[model samples]
Target: MKRILPLLLTLVMAQPLGAHPHVFIDTGLTLAFGPEGRLQRVKVIWIYDAFYSLLITQDMDLDQDGDGLLNPDEKAQLTGFDMQWVEGFNGDLVITQEGQELALSGPQDVTATFVEGQIVTTHWRDVTQDTAGSGTYEVTPYDASYYTAYEVTLPVEILGADQCRSRIAMPDITADLDALRQELFALDRQAQPEDAGLPNIGAKFADKVVVTCASS
Candidate 1:
């Protein structure tokens, strides 16, 4: 299936555009634990900004009546439109334990809807690693190239694990942006940041949700 957003092509190319994030997403996360207290899955919720939502609606020919709401048929057509990810795509989510990134299965239980002129979507990702005994984990959502910005604006919930709790660690936007600007200025006029071996600065600006378990 074709992806719903064509701008994703630019994101995958990772061009050195040197521009701010064009697409904004308000992200929500729910951590699900298994009977043994291991991290089982993550339920992700994405609410796109109004402008981008409008673009998506236009691209899909949805909301033909311009009523700012999707009917049943439109909702069905919009479902899973963003789930058809390209190869090497990380789904913009990262889960790490002790600095080692854990593996996650592809998106499942995908659903989508149109609400108040915004696009809202949800999906599930199974944590394929055994994290039962791990006391702490980091979950981050970001676009490496900074093409899209993800803000953990919604509440973070822990499910099936009373001992586990989550806290959001927000980055220092001013400091991060200052550093990015210096790096960009250091680059030769003809050289792109990627060509200059600059690291993924987007990670520096990401909000990290730290999940800790008192008893595992």
Candidate 2:
């Protein structure tokens, strides 16, 4: 558990520079299937940025040993603490099969570890149903509020699917920026940037991995 006084003071005393994603995460994903070739689960790994890593280390008392690193017990505690999500937070991962979205459950087998002054979290969750399709299915991780920015740190791994291929499609930030500029200029005097054009610009900027499997 996090210390209340420090956590509260840290949150309240510091002024935010801007929007939500004051934290950045480098993300990795692995898609796994059962022997029958149906989609079973998705594993995700998040590596925190340096500043946030420092904050988390303090909040979680990750360096209890005073050697400036997380010990075994601290690592276990960190995993459990970070795995807890606030109500309605969907882990920021999405999946769709042939344009139909599939609901994903909560994370399991979660573990958090400290590596070279950074906090790394890994977990997996099962998808709702078997995805059977030759058409494109997409997996993406993003915060709709743009509170946290995510970068793909590794190519998405595919497991247990003999004939499937996956490719990553990254969003064009330049195009999104240009579009946002146009929208701002087109706005009326009373218009707000939030309401001007694209609401969830983060989603537009999210990186997606497209997977296609041959029909058995």
TM-score versus the correct structure, for each prediction: 0.85, 0.81
Q: How accurate is candidate 1 locally (lDDT)?
A: 0.81
The candidate maximizing TM-score is 1
- Supply candidate 1's per-residue lDDT for 19: 47
lDDT at 133, model 2: 38
84-181, model 2: which lDDT tens digit per residue?
Answer: 67666688888998888888888899988888878888999898866573556799888764546788866689898877898888887597676664
Q: Which candidate ranks first by lDDT, i.e. highest?
A: 1
Provide the lowest-lDDT 10-residue window in model 1. 1-10
Residue 51: error of model 2 in Å? 0.7
Model 1 TM-score is 0.85
lDDT of 1 by residue, 72-139 (tens): 99999999888989887889999987677889999999999899999999999999985654588899
